[model samples]
Target: MAKPQDLPLELLQFYLTAPYPCSYLDNEEARSQVLAPNSPINSHIYSELVRHGFRRSGSFTYRPHCDQCQACVPVRVNVEEFIWRRINRRIFKKNQDLTVHHQRLVFKEEHFQLYLAYQQARHPKGDTDTDSKEQYVHFLIHSPVNSELIEFRLNNQIVMVSVIDYLDDGISSVYTFFDPTQPDRSLGQFNILWQLNLCRTLTLPWLYLGYWIKECRKMNYKIQFQPLEGLIDHQWQPLAFAQE
Candidate 1:
């Protein structure tokens, strides 16, 4: 087998990670086709890679390389034509009191605490040690590409924090965590909408929402935002769905 480094520098090289337990599926293993970290994969390279169905975690870029599954679909919102339905509008209204700020990456104790609470509440069975500040900083704060720590505060209380990457074309949502106790506010959905609004303000064409798994209930939210573009068979296509 050829190592990623052996490939010519003019072209991006990828390495396959050994399969592990699949996080999104039960009784399955998942492998990743990772872009070797040694290359000069800056925001420009990452932006192009995402168009080819790649995504970043920390400084590494990767896509699903599972042998028997193609369930992980890379998706992005058509921010230019994104429509806010009645319920979506209500969600925006529900979060009216929250003030949003787009700032450079910084790890805050408040954000870490909320993230811990969110992980415990939302993913109790997961193996990750979300309580570690080191992992949090490594995941959300450290990045080779241009990124931001978007804060959503309600009544001056830190309710939500979203880490997103900036591409020349649009923004890619890296991760988001909120006060899981306040389920009524729908912080998860609002975060995307907020980014879409930001995309419009910047005149960007898309807002990459990361991987969307049709069989995963938690991931179903990505498709709810209409006119979703999914990378299928190495090409981007519109997912067929009726507007509600």
Candidate 2:
């Protein structure tokens, strides 16, 4: 396996995207430093990129590079040190009947339908809610690295799906969508708990959770999981605010 320092210099080259509308913040523009499209991205290279605060969207690997704003902070869970609060334990117990299946990155109609429903219910009229089949396929099914699709089924019915990347050091939670109507099920929280357990079972120490924005209500749930470390100033440190 190639180490981070052993990666070819060409792979380090990046393309800065033109400022686009910020997804998390209103009326603000955002830019990304994206890896060159031609560069070969395998598991090891992507693992190195994640360690440097980058995230994968489909086959694209990029990180926030706003010219003046630095609101986006990469975060990961110290799975080995994760604390299970009362709510977390309750969520785990509630989801005990759900069966888990690990799958490859193949296109499945049922998964797409569930994703569409989730987007419409949770993010109605948002960017992904109106996605066509091709767009949905391009968004989640086109990974070039080691990725897995975890399906959560209840009574043999698909209830949720999580896309995860297997990093050299840990697992990266790419994306998760669940049956929005089942709020009581707390499938999202259960999925994270399951990933944390998986990390322990695999003896991995971290669970990369992409980026966290303090002001984004959609992201507020991330900090609730204890022992989260954020990438700040190129260093991973325990988020002081999260400690509270």
Candidate 3:
């Protein structure tokens, strides 16, 4: 077992071969990845890896690295410049009744039940299938650095949750789930908007939003946040509606 301190900053090099068809695209193939070991410089390494478009999972950090597909674009919102559009404002007002609480990651029965409900309602066919307590800990509680669970409540009842990883430069939205029964509230959209606001309040400039795959409809919503940047050729490029 590798201790947290044993983890490396720079990924040496890793490889993977897909089992079959890819999830993002129908005709595309999926690939695997591995990383090399550097030093256990958590904060510095995380910042560098993110700027380079890699996402963290457990002790390993990886990028798309898929040869057949370059659709997974890394996205980050410009906190200082983000402007809430009409729809976003509506969502903010809609969810105004909910109260948010932030705390360190800890497994609770209520959270597990909510997570299970969210998985079954939103991603029934997802890999985990059922959101068990052990699975919840593995997925949400397991972290190498500072992490927190942001829970939203309504009338003292838990309704939504977001797993966040804190780094020196920004906050990475590891995962988020909500009571799917409230479709009118658009919890997913609200969660992102809330996170952006939280980042602004904390003076964090970037809010890492995982990947934005143009071919994946589920991921298209990420682009709605204007004044965002995407990683292209190892550089952060501004997203523009009309480009030369």
Candidate 4:
């Protein structure tokens, strides 16, 4: 086994496997391979991999490698050309009363409680019953690369939190949880909007939104963020809604 630091640039390759039981699909199986990047030139390697639609996971990176099904498309927002539409502007105003606290990855009891609430509300019939503090830390706080916890607070109380990975090219949103009781606020949409704003402020050209599946209505919201590019046939192609 090669040490993470010993991996060479030329050895970095994207591999795929046969599809297995899919997490998102009822009868489909998800197949993906480990993306090993040369850690010696970590930042440069990460930047290159991300351009190819690979997402970081701790010290290693990977993307969907499903066979026969190419529904999981990697999407990225071109920050410089992004225009906030009427709905987006309205969301910004709705969340104006909420304060965003960006901080280093830190897990607390309160965060776990909120995580449990989000899972129970959003995925009650799913495998989200495991809501222990250790599980929360392992899932969100344990990371090998630079990561941050963006907490959204209203009335001095934490309502939403997003675990984000800071890659060389752009920010990778690992996961997010919020108080599901406040459905009217639409925290999920607000989180993405906030991330886009952060990227613009930092002058980063892209925001690596993990994957978009056409069949999943829950994931379809990603397409609403216009002027995004989707990885198609190993190339980034501009997705034009007008043509659809």
Best of the candidates, TM-score: 2
Candidate 3 stretches with Cα past 4 Å from truth are: 1-21, 36-41, 127-130, 241-244
Model 3 TM: 0.86
The C-alpha lDDT values of all candidates are 0.86, 0.91, 0.79, 0.78
In model 2, what is the error at residue 192, expressed in angstroms?
A: 0.5
Q: Which tens-of-lDDT digit does each residue in 1-244 have in candidate 4?
A: 9754466546766566666788777898888876634334355566666677777654557778776788888888888787789989888789999998889988677888899888888777876435667667767887666678999999989999998877766777788899998988888998989998898888778888888877787787788787888988989988775124
Preferred candidate (lDDT higher): 2 or 4: 2
Model 2 RMSD in angstroms? 2.0
Q: Clashing residue pairs, candidate 2? A: none
- My TM-score estimates for the predictions, one after another, are 0.93, 0.95, 0.86, 0.87
lDDT of 2 by residue, 47-91 (tens): 888999999899899999998899999999999789989999999
Residue 71 error, candidate 3, Å: 0.9
Put down candidate 3 lDDT per residue, 103-132, tens digits, no spaces.
898888888888888888867787774456
lDDT-better candidate, 2 vs 3: 2
**Relative to the unseen true structure, what is the C-alpha lDDT of residue 146 in candidate 3, on a scale of 0 to 100?**
74
Q: Is candidate 1 or candidate 2 better by lDDT?
A: 2
- Candidate 2's C-alpha runs over 4 A off are 1-5, 8-11, 127-130
Each model's total of backbone clashes: 0, 0, 4, 4
Worst 10 residues of 2 by lDDT: 2-11
**Local accuracy of candidate 1 as per-residue lDDT tens digits, 37-145:** 7776667777888888888887778899999999999998999778789989999888988998989999889999999889999888766765689988887889988
